[model samples]
Target: MLVGSPKVRMPPGPRGPAALNTLRLVQRPVESMIGWRRRYGDIFTVRLLVFGTGVYVSDLDEIKAMFTGDQSSLRAGEANAPLAPVLGSRSVLILDGPEHLRQRRLLLPPFQGSAVERFREVIAEVAEAEVARWSVGDRFRMRDRMRELTFEVIVRAVFGVTDPARIERLRSALVAVIDSQAVLLVPGALRRDLGGVGPWAAFQRRKRAADALLYEEIEHRRRDDDLGERSDVLSLLLRARDEDGRPLSDAELRDELMTLLLAGHETTATSLAFAFDLLPRHPRVLARLRDELAGGGADYLGAVVSETMRIRPVLDAAERTLTEPRTVCGWDLPAGIRVYPAILAVQHRPDLYPEPGRFRPERFLAEDPPPYAWIPFGGGIRRCIGAALAQAEMAEVIRTVVERVDLEPVRPEPEPVVIRGITMVPRHGTPVRVARITG
Candidate 1:
């Protein structure tokens, strides 16, 4: 799409010191986005140390056009380079143009609805085991439990790592990398390896260890005699081939595995954490969800997950780079500009969602939600590959936990949202007390 140069203009935005902008973003990104949208309108610019020129878009029509825009013009891989250190430079998340399409097409089949459905039992079993270990009547951080639960499910169902020793080994290495908190390139000497001892050094060590295990797994899976018959994601990936019939190389396989591991676990776990935190605090929703779960139907359970993500999206925005000058949302964006789909702002729009502040699952259940309106899994071609799997995991886990026990918020008020790594999670991990164990 092209527009007259006179009609196309740079969107209005905040002009400030980069450090101040970065600080506001780091401190309260969701709030900052909403404030910026109000101040600067539907589309605006935010300059951060990380993203040189960030343009955020929240209008539904504009988001739809941008998402479905020419892939060559809107390159997500360049915008997602910040994740390359962890997901790898070859990861589908960090590849653009024909290369990105090749990776995405090859990676899409295993995460299809039918393939993900086969793992419901795995999700249930993992969630049940974790929930069972929770001590009744004691306050605990739900995020910790959810993280452990999601990580185990991913290891078993995605990697097919059922062996106790291997599972523990992979788990240890992965946790070290994930918990390091500098994967996205933090500031100053902290972002560099200081004689192999500081945060950056520790991250480098953990990443190396994790990479070793992942490479070993890839090599083993490639050699599996019954690789085609295996139902795990890694096995499916092993069998996947491009149009030219070439299989993924060890490096490609390793990066994709890392993408699935990092993208799949913490994001889902954080969503589950938010669900658990929100459910007990809003007794009406909890009671209704339990009533639906008792009937062995997930219609309402699905709505609850949708509502939770709507209210508390784990990731605030998704970024795309303007590879060529293009008109987006009436703003003439230049090449090299980073355009962000403001998920948090769009999801919370009062016009789209009445009483947007309140926790309401009925909003989703009552109507066919508008497109590009509730994009927790993002939208269009660059949408999350594991969207179906993530939602299924959330439903099964929530079903497993709610049916097995009763819970109450440790504090009367809702937990404050805080930025943790790439995800926005509950500040105190959404503390909760188990009132009783039903099963």
Candidate 2:
């Protein structure tokens, strides 16, 4: 399904087998990308395992151009078709142009700074309760703890599910689907159900269970007499009407809810895991953050979160396929080829952030990187809808954990990066031993 053009002037890249390039890229994405950027310079191309001819741009000027290109021509939804199986076709993640804009408008109100700020209390309460259960000297994976905390926040704030029994049931069902998603990334030839005996079949079963719980919640909320009085995301979305005074369909509601649950539950938790991994290894940075938290300052805490995201971004790149032939980053790109802003490569540019490999939250405190240079949440009109909410959750979780307890890395070296579903996560889950309970 790759869109190709005979007249296309493709950027220079490895002339070898696409499968081999994809194999190394899949095994070690960050290192492979860094090597490609060094070898091929600012802009280059790679043919994925199955996806064809992806051009990667790391320069700020080109990145800006690609992000701000003509909206109609840049078909991110088509490029994101792989997600449709899990997220559903109606999801905001897989829609393009006008339909995408419509979903964004209806969903934007609840994710605003003002709206997300309201969840701080809920996030904090969840954080405190979660850390409270952490034994003083026990070694544990911060990723595991963070996932539990994030999932509970989604259940309470996003779904407004308060009943202990119902929350547990919903959480269990959702995690089942999330855990088996690696089955979706393989070649189409290998994705068959095989009489309900394969990973795909198993994944389908989990997806159905999760969908049933979600649909139940949607219908149950629709019948609630006091829905209008609630401010939970699900409630607000339920009350939302488009310009035509039309409410979202049941499928729309379910897909959007699933998208949000996946974003907040996976991306934010993984970012926090990376933060925990970095802080214990960098004593100076850790000390400065503890001081800022102790003094009740906000700027440094915000900077810490920004630096964490910039250094080890969860999602690798924001993708789009061209519907028509268009010039991008000074290259005569053909329609159907995917163009990536190369989020990881751009952020690690040595010129943009001196000593890019170091974990220095102070750099963010002192100065801002160039606009296109530090895009972890992405840019343009298509930026991630949950950006503000994700950062707020990260801040509150980090604040609560640092204030209540001290953590020490279980290993001398920080955990290496590994792919988990779509996000880059700490390989060892950032194992740590709770050093002390300060608060």
lDDT against true structure, model 2: 0.85
lDDT of 1 by residue, 339-431 (tens): 888999898888889888799998888886799889988888889998999999999998988888998888778877877666788888888
- All candidates: TM-score: 0.92, 0.93
RMSD of each: 3.2, 2.4
Model 2 C-alpha lDDT per residue in residues 238-289, reported as the tens digit of each score = 9999999999999999999988887678788899999999887887877888
- For model 2, the run of ten residues with the poorest summed lDDT: 1-10
